[model samples]
Target: MNATNAPDTVFETQRPRLFALAYRLLGSRSEAEDVVQDAWLRWHQTDRAAVRDPEAWLVTATTRLGIDRLRAVRSERIAYPGPWLPEPLTVDESPGPEHRSELAEQVSIAFLAVLERLGPEERAAFLLKEAFDYDYDQIAELLDRTEANCRQMVHRARERLQSGRPRFEVEPARHRELLERFMHAAQRGDRGAITGLLDANARLVSDGGGKARAVIRPLLGGERIARLYWAVARRNGYSDWRMGTLNGEPAVLGYTDGVLTSATVAVSDGEHILELLTLRNPDKLPIPH
Candidate 1:
């Protein structure tokens, strides 16, 4: 292996895993890319011969970078006008340690919501252990903490996560069907039908970023959320919805007369949706094809 080519080859090989680690930590593609780039710069400058564990070195670099970036952003988010949702990442499949279907589930809008609530260290510790399957010892070394401390952090993250996460998983086909039912009722403003399709504890969170007409806080309960849906359809006359995939899950790419205005994803527990996420922030929404 030549001097220059070796580093590029090594960085490229681990890029996806590094990016995944950053993305899950920061929850922003742009920021994650920046973090990965920073890791590359450091890797390129480091003494490669002395680094016995390239992946370990890269993982540590990427994760610590993520935690730093996350801490900086957490302050910015405090000033954000309303509740902030992670930028919806579209992934057909993530090439990482987790199983494809399971990974997809973990990246769902709802799951990310739970992760967003966690502190930076807690998030790092949890994702390393749960999603990436890093052993506690490895995680402790990565985070510069003791193994027992990392284990405790992961346990607390799990407890906090479980309280807000969905209880069951739905297959892709069933997920699509649920989105269809949601679209049908939402378009027609059928409160009763919407109620039947929503869990008793269903919650709706809209992110307009203060640039669009959206609720600034979470709307809780099935009946109340159904009413809000009715109000939206009535005002916008959006009786039609286009089916699409967001983050590899069935989602509603809502349109007003063929003009894309909103994108929505739901997290369901087999029987009904447990949480719904609507993104109306144009800047936050994905670019059109």
Candidate 2:
């Protein structure tokens, strides 16, 4: 196809994949949409004839833009009001089942929370290599680093990921069961039952952004975590919290006056809850109820 006609066709063919890549890397649907729009503008202004592989070119463009924005945003993150979770996506259009599943896995609360620990370059390198399956050479080109350096970044990121969690998948049904029990125990002020559902070293992290009451530091251990939940429930009283899937994983949504005020996603091992992440910052609740 000629340069004039090729850009339009190429854009339509590649937009979805590019958006997916950007969203997984950045962990915000709105930011990902912005990145895609910026990529399209850059593509439109480029001399298409000079590009041999349009898809590869677009991918490189999008990744670089996302990386740049992430670097600029990282400094501001330290000053962010509360536990900064990635913005939740509210899918208006129905994508196919496979696409939906893939998006969920990539943008899950657990996955995005982990990504926050990496440096911007490391995140870009790892996302490009792991999620996109880009080779060392391609990744090197994307990050403007040597192939050896790119490989090392990916290696470090993989090691961190493996060392952090068990390889167990918490089924949705079982997750719901555990969450219900945990919530019931908290509401009833039954500390024993609440602690029973938690791992010995369970952690509770709350991101109320300093606006609502949340533990600034992660509360560790089953006893401590259970006590914290009970205290919060007692102090605030249980709003009408509904159980639902946040990113295809079990979650609890706290609502007041029919508006979702906050939501919690629990990461569990087979027997106990490992982590409880509550997203109460109004900024992070952009996901539609």
Per-candidate TM-scores read: 0.90, 0.88
118-229, model 2: which lDDT tens digit per residue?
8878988999888888899989887789999998999899888776655888665676688878877777777889999999998877887777767777778999987876
Candidate 1 ranges beyond 4 A from true positions: 91-103, 256-259
The residue-level lDDT of candidate 1 at 187 comes to 90
Predicted candidate 1 versus true structure: per-residue lDDT over 1-289, tens digit per residue: 8876988998999999999889889877788999999999999889899999999999999999999999999988788878888876662222222223555666766677679889999999999998899999899999999999998999999999988875665676776678778888999888889999998889899988889878899999998999988887788674556677666666778665666667788888777987898888777666544
The residue-level lDDT of candidate 2 at 13 comes to: 98
- Candidate 2 global Cα RMSD: 3.4
Which 10-residue window in model 1 sums to the lowest lDDT?
A: 91-100
Residue 271 lDDT (model 1): 77
| Candidate 2 worst ten-residue window by lDDT | 91-100
